[model samples]
Target: MAFLFPLSTFLLPAGGEYGDVRASFDEAKLNAYLAKSVPAVKAPVTIKQFKSNPTYFLTDARTVSIQTAHQVEREYTMLAAIHNYNSRPTTAPEARVPVPQVFVLCEDKEVIGTPFYIMEFLEGRIFTDMSMPGVPLEVRRECWLSAVRALGALSSLDPKDVGLEILIKSLSKVSLAQAAVKDIDTGEPVGEITGWRELIGWYESNLPDERKTGVRIVHGDYKLDNLIFHPTENRVIGILDWELCTLGSPLADLGNLTQPWVFDLADVGTLMVGFKNNPGAEPISLEDLEREYCRVTRQPYPIVEIGFARSWMLFRLSVIMQGIAARRARGQASSEQAHLYASFFNVLGRLARGVLEDEGYLPKSRAKL
Candidate 1:
């Protein structure tokens, strides 16, 4: 299905002439149009499209007509925000997660009939399957570990420094102001202390411990496929899909990223939501990823937090599938295989409940999920 405005989704057409085809459209035509209309969109060789990977953004485009103006502004604004993050001198060295550079954002919607942007054409590898089939086990271990390190590096960045404070309240629901830098040793603001200048959403209530965690620019959707890896090395060359990016709990990204290991299809059967555990990389565990994340962030291993985050993410993924399924039922399915995801709603709910039970938050059940 061709998305108007592009990013892989750089284009899911809005109303007017593009009013209809939101549910289904020709990707080849869209790709060709992108190649012709946007010269900067090179081969996009790094971004490979796979139907099974579940990128279905099934929101109905009918009501989009009313929201078109607001949507246009929001879309272009986010593109600029991310570009700001990438263009910062300190971002590449500190975050270690590369973002495609936005050369220009055309919000007029007159040229392309929808908002679109020209981004750097990253040439690398995007493994749709989390298992990373055909790759060596050592490579898989290193690649996965590198992804963790990248996330940690991103989390450690101060949002204000990256020009991301403006997005916190509107997106992540946090208000940002310049507080004096805190000293790790003395536990007091060291810089010029100022009011309304602190990362206040540091404590997460969802976790068992009220530990103060670093506020990070959360990549709401962080997973293997969303990343572009170096063609030969195990390093991560780029991060994709910033639509869900925001300033929020680092745990949200960690939770979303680590769900694959927790929901091994062999162990949970129907409850397994997305990717399956790769038997080839059996030596590596979810804990290993957590260890790398903690090591990079210099934070203690958060066992309880991990459990909560994983279960929460499972429920969240299921809800997304459920929404797509609803759109499918309405005959507005953005892609062909949306029916495959409809059935996962109940099973994923069971998995989320099961995890809660295991953590002693819910009562145990004799019935198998």
Candidate 2:
């Protein structure tokens, strides 16, 4: 059976303080939008904004959330997320999902500057850190394995089957290299971080032919925090934040999953602070996780050109972080962790440089922080 459940009857208190600093939406305007756009809801439906940053909302009987696309187009990512969720195969008995059923797409400038969509609110816990305190190690392991299965399931599907051919383009290693060059040429600011330019140059020069492969729908941000776990079990009930979903190498998702481990944040003053130090359970290594994922999917291990893939993914992330930093600087960012995100540009850049050096694409040299 589908993991369907009633919207939580009791309104849970907001997880954090609500204020101007936190991203929020106008309830009156949202209600007005709903009144006109979604026929299911009556005119006088109430909208309550959650205290969480990049505010989520709980309506009378449904949940509404907003996604603002500053660098990448929001509509495309939002639609992709919905499509992936709805189109995902239900073959796995254990893979229960409360996929978002987007009711309305609102682009009315008066409602909000950027476009937003209303979808079903899923009730579950979101573990933002690896250290799932108070949770059993076996349960944590199960959760991690469930996530891997979800990723494998997502990667195994054809993008064409879900009508994502146009919205999400398949990217090859060569295409990624070319895109890197294009970004640099367009003055995307390759800051004076030590190996930033060298890494790009490596990509431009060593474009590998064998790295080209079939495209899969990639959840750009596939981590424990983005997944919604069952209230009492280790199973993943729902996936959130499709803002970064795209068509790319499946390895990109793997790279994203393993990026945090590649760059330990013990002393980094970023958002992922305490979790690293106090991880309640011993985390699984990326290698073991990848092996199990390959075994479950019956796909060969991606052992070749793994380094290049890591560098490409990290470099792309650094570019994205740069855009976030720009938005935060201009007072246009919506994420409550905007400042923390802004601080990650250098850290990510250095990490990318480190990957390139390890891959023999660049000499062993530290990037100037």
Candidate 3:
């Protein structure tokens, strides 16, 4: 699964064009669909594809993003988006993180095989790297705080009250372990040196008895890239990629944010999406970020061992990588980085094992497991 190009190059395409794995839309077809679906939009609407994976179409005044029902149901994402829009607080501090307005939802099979939603394009800057040269340290800190506050606000809401009961569900650690085993069986490449089955077995055995399993709205993929920051102000204006939003442990999102600190960018590229690190800006420690999140949210520091959450996140990421590999194998992957991601399965597994070992969940004598 090794590629001629590095993971960074594979993930980031040149000239900002959609990557090969993306399904390109014919301009005429998109225009036709938009004309009918959004009558308010005038004729001859221009269409340009976003360079990112999960390709989006930018029309005259709005952006159209599409999602397939492969992992999470597209309908659930749509419902979550609507709920976020409707229930967003209007008052002070909590209103800082704004949800983009979802304008239209199209489910017509004739237009496309899968459902797509159109929403207002929030004008802002997305900092792919927190350490970028021009971005000040203060800005980076604000960005981190903004993300923490956003997650806090999200976790504060009751999923049932927001009409997300059907869309959000409690995640089972057992089910996660089972899925990891299945991924290995299904040609997900893992390390021959490490026993994945043993690792998972150890995880199951060490499951926290009084784990904080409280359900909250979890942003499945919360990271620097997924957030839209205000162009001038050092505040988060919008949060993107709601496809994986669900009712789960708030710690899951927190664990995701801490992933970059766990594995270097050079080692894993970008687990979520590839982006270069800002060499100029000093990096923040995972401990500081976690402390900030707890402070902003006023939630107690996690009682469950941090390693458990880290291991779960790593396992979750491995499953996602396995899916990407399966798609690449079937010629359905949208990004060139799919193969690169597939190649990292072993690395992910090893990292998960390392987390357990560091936390003393696994003994040195049994490290091979």
Best by TM-score: 3
Candidate 2 residue spans exceeding 4 A from truth: 1-39, 52-54, 62-98, 110-114, 166-190, 205-213, 266-282, 324-344, 359-361, 366-369
Question: Candidates 1 and 2: which is better by lDDT?
Answer: 2
Cand. 2 Cα-lDDT? 0.58
Q: Residues 1-369, candidate 3, lDDT per residue (tens digit)?
A: 000111232222222343343564455765688777775455455444444445454545533444433332443454445446456565346633366655566666556556666555555666665453465567677777777778776655555555555355423443344334424335653323234576666766865443354566777887766776666776776776666776656777877877766664665655543122534334555566777777766656753556887787787777666556555655676776777986666677777777777778776544332
Each candidate's clash count: 15, 0, 2
What is every candidate's alpha-carbon RMSD to the true fold? 14.1, 6.6, 6.6
lDDT of 1 by residue, 170-202 (tens): 311211111222334454532211111111121
Give the candidate order by descending TM-score: 3, 2, 1
Q: Worst ten-residue run, lDDT, model 3?
A: 1-10
Ranking by lDDT: 2, 3, 1
Candidate 1 residue spans exceeding 4 A from truth:
1-94, 165-211, 266-283
How would you encode candidate 2's per-residue C-alpha lDDT over 1-369 as one tens digit per residue? 011223342122113223232444566786777777787655555443444434444456544444444322443444545455555575454332334555666666677555665555566656656656666677777888888877766666666655664355332342333323323224553233335667677766865443344677677777767776676667676766665676657777766766655655553554542233334424665677788778755767865656776777777776666666665555677887877876676676677777777667678874343
Which segments of candidate 3 are over 4 A away from where they belong? 1-44, 61-97, 166-193, 202-213, 264-282, 325-339, 365-369
Model 2: per-residue Cα lDDT at residue 323: 63
For residue 121, give model 1's deviation from the true position in Å. 0.4
Clashes of 1: 15
Better candidate number, 2 or 3, judged by TM-score: 3
